[model samples]
Target: MTIRFDGQVALVTGAGAGLGRAYALDLAARGAKVVVNDLGGDPHGQGENRAAAQKVVDEIKAAGGEGVPNFDSVSSYDGGFNMVKTAIDTYGRLDVVICNAGILRDVAFHNMSEEDWDKVFAVHLKGSFTVLRAAWPVFRQQSYGRVMLTTSSSGIWGQFGQANYGAAKTGMLGLMNVLKQEGVKYNTMVNTVAPVAGTRLTASVMPQEMVDKLKPEFVSPAVVYMVSNECSTSGYVIEAGAGNFSRASMVKGPGAQPGMAANLDAEWVQANWDRICSLEGAVPMWRAGQTLAAFQAANAKQA
Candidate 1:
């Protein structure tokens, strides 16, 4: 079946360049009315202008797609509200938001400044939350919405010179998880994507061999599905790159227990550390409820 977003509106932050630009264009081409937003900042989050995102909007309109350009930064409450305001003012309603805005302020752990830490979080972590805080009520009223969070492998796996960026990305893993639980009440969906391509944020670190393999277009299809009403998932993180896609996930190990008559003790925990930390026979689960049920079942066996 064709995945079409006809009559839908999407706001994509950081849409001026890189992965954000690619996602904005893809949505517009597939019948979405897009809001292309960018602050026109440097890689370090230091500036603002309009040409970058505006150009993308012009391109979409030229191709017969509907779109508008917004130069608001996603790093503040006012800006987040305004971004949503633009979609409502122009397109009448919003169906999706791709929180893809981010910046790099690389420094050693000891040298990281308050400015560096705050700006990085402002764009990547708090930025995503601010937009959602502004949009959640509207989504609730409409009874439908989609949120796509931009996370990174660097954060998931850890990297040097990225303490600030990594912390923000990892925060999204938890942010989206909680959002998923909340979204279930209103039929909203939220998911994270760790993309790998030769985008501006990735160019220096990506080698030619890897670049040749990870096209943004290849990853777009998966994104389209996740943001569409067709997807039956939330609180999930999917890693896409180099023609390989996998779900990077968290797991609760099958832990050990002393007899039901005995209280849990440090000595018991030490003895069962292997099972508590074991990844062998690990199963992929999506929510806390599932883990709770599994734990209860394991406890019942002892009882």
Candidate 2:
């Protein structure tokens, strides 16, 4: 079946160029009224160029799709509110939000400055909060919404000189985990995308040929699907890029239950370290309470 947005409205932050621009254009092309938002900042989040967002909006219009340009920084609360307002004012409703706005400050942890950490968190982590906090109410009241947050491989795994960026990206998972539960009752589905596309943020690190192959557009299809009405699952972490897609998740090992003993001590933990850390019979944990349940079930089986 064809996935179409039809009368729905979507807001894509950092839509000036790269992934955000690709998302906005794709959503608009599929019949969504898109709000193209870009701070117009450089890769490091400096300076501004309003033309960046307007150009994408122009493309949407040129292709007979509806779109409006927004020049707000996602780091600001007012900027987030205004972006949502733009969609409601122009399209009368908002059905999707793709929090793709991000900035990077790569430096070794020891050499990282407070500003480096703060700026990256402000754009990638807090920026997501600002927009979602603004749009959350609308989603609940309407009882329908699809939210897509951007994560990264650097964040999920380790990366050199990207402590700040990686930490902020990993934080997206926690946010989605909580929002998924809260929004479930309202039919508001939230998911994260860890994309490996070559964008402005990565252009400096990769060769031109590799960048050409890892086009941002290749990652958009999975993202658009996750935020569409057809997607039934929520709180998932999907990795996509270069025509590959996969799910990433948190799993727990079959842990040692030495702590259940009355004389549980550090010595016991030390002796059972290998068992505690073993991945044998590991299971995916969908919620916090599952840990306790898994432990209890293991104990019952042993008894």
Candidate 3:
């Protein structure tokens, strides 16, 4: 079946360019009224240009879709509130939120300043919180909502010289885990996207030829579907780009328990270190309690 948004409204942060622009355009094309929000900052989160946002809104309108421009920084609580307010005021209600705004401060951990860390977190981690927190009430009130948060490979796995960015990106997973549970009863779904796309954020690090191959548009399909009513799964992490899509998840190994002895020591752990770190019998954990449950089950078996 073809997925569409019809009467739904969506708010896309950082809609001025790149992946955010691609997502906003696609969502609008699919019949959703979109709020194209962009602080219009440079790739490093500096400066502003109101036209950056208006241009996308214009594109949406030119395509015969409904949209409005919002020049608000997602890092600010008030900015996030106003972004949601613009959607509600213009389209009446919001059904989707795509937290795609971000800035880069790539530096080695030793060289990374507190300012760099704070700024990155403010835009990525705190920015996500600000917007989602504002939209949370509406989702609960309406009993239906869809959310897509942007994560990165740097955060999901690891990359040298990106401690701040990685930390902030990984934080999205934690947020998704809790929000998924809270929104389940309300019919709200929250999922994350770790997009491997060639955008402004990666232009400096990636080769020009590779950038041309990994278009931002290639990642939008998965993101759009994740935020559509047709998608019921929540708390999922999808990696998409260059027409490739895959699911990433947190898994736990069948850990060595070292018996029920109260005085389990470093020696016991050392003896079973390989077993403790082995992934031979690892299982994907869907919830936090599952890890503990697995441990209890293993203890019972030992008894």
Candidate 4:
């Protein structure tokens, strides 16, 4: 079956370039009305230009697809609200949202300043929240919506000199987890992508050979599929780039229990350390309830 968005409206933050641009363009090509939003800031999240957004809109029009340019910063509430307003005012409804706007501030944990941490969080984490919150009501009223939050390998597995960026990216996963539950009844699915695309953000850090292979376009397909009507599963994290796609999750091992007795101490935990950390029988948790249930089951076995 062909996945198309004939009457759908989509908003792609940071659409001026990279993954966001690819997503916006592809959505338009598939018959969706797209809102191309970009503050045109540098990699560190400074400065802005209206032309960046206008260019993408022009490209969409040239390809016989409908699109509008929005020059709103996703870092603030007002900016996020206005971007969604632009979509509703132009297309009359919104069906999808791609929270791809972000900034990078790389620094060692010891040297990272308060400003560095705050700025990264503002763009990646708070920005996603701002836009999603603004669109929550519309999604609820329409009884349908698809949201894609951008995560990163640095956030999931960790990376040196990227403490701030990693923390914000991981926080997005937490937000997605909650939204998935809240939106399930409304047919609003929330998912995440930990993309390894060769964009301005990664140009300096990644090796040239790897960068050549991991184009921004390679990452957009996963984004497109995740937000399409064909996909219904939520609370999923997909890693995509260079024609490679895979799912990632947090899993738990079969941990050792200290029992329900009062005399249990740190020594007991130390003695059973290997069992606590063993990967055997590890499983990905579907929800918070599973963790508690697993603990209880383990205790029952001990009893």
TM-score winner: 3
Which residue runs does candidate 2 get wrong by more than 4 Å? 293-303
Residue runs of model 1 more than 4 Å from their true location after superposition: 207-213, 263-265, 285-301
For residue 241, model 2's alpha carbon misses the true position, in angstroms, by 0.6
lDDT scores for all predictions? Answer: 0.87, 0.92, 0.93, 0.92
Write out the backbone clash pairs for model 3. none
The best candidate in terms of lDDT:
3
In terms of TM-score, which candidate is stronger, 1 or 3? 3
lDDT of 1 by residue, 196-280 (tens): 7777667667786666566787777778889997897988899986677899987755556555677778888888788878878
> How do all the candidates rank in terms of TM-score, highest first?
3, 2, 4, 1
Question: Could you tell which candidate, 2 or 3, scores higher by TM-score?
Answer: 3
Q: 124-216 in candidate 4: lDDT tens per residue?
A: 999998899899999999999999999999889999999999999999889988899999899999999999888888989888887777888
Worst 10 residues of 3 by lDDT: 254-263
Judged by TM-score relative to the true structure, which candidate is superior, 2 or 4?
Answer: 2
Ranking according to lDDT, highest score first? 3, 2, 4, 1
C-alpha RMSD in Å of predicted model 3 compared with the true structure: 1.4
CA shift at 287, candidate 2, in angstroms? 2.2
Mark the 10 consecutive residues where model 1 has the least summed lDDT: 251-260
- What's the TM-score of every candidate structure? 0.92, 0.96, 0.96, 0.95
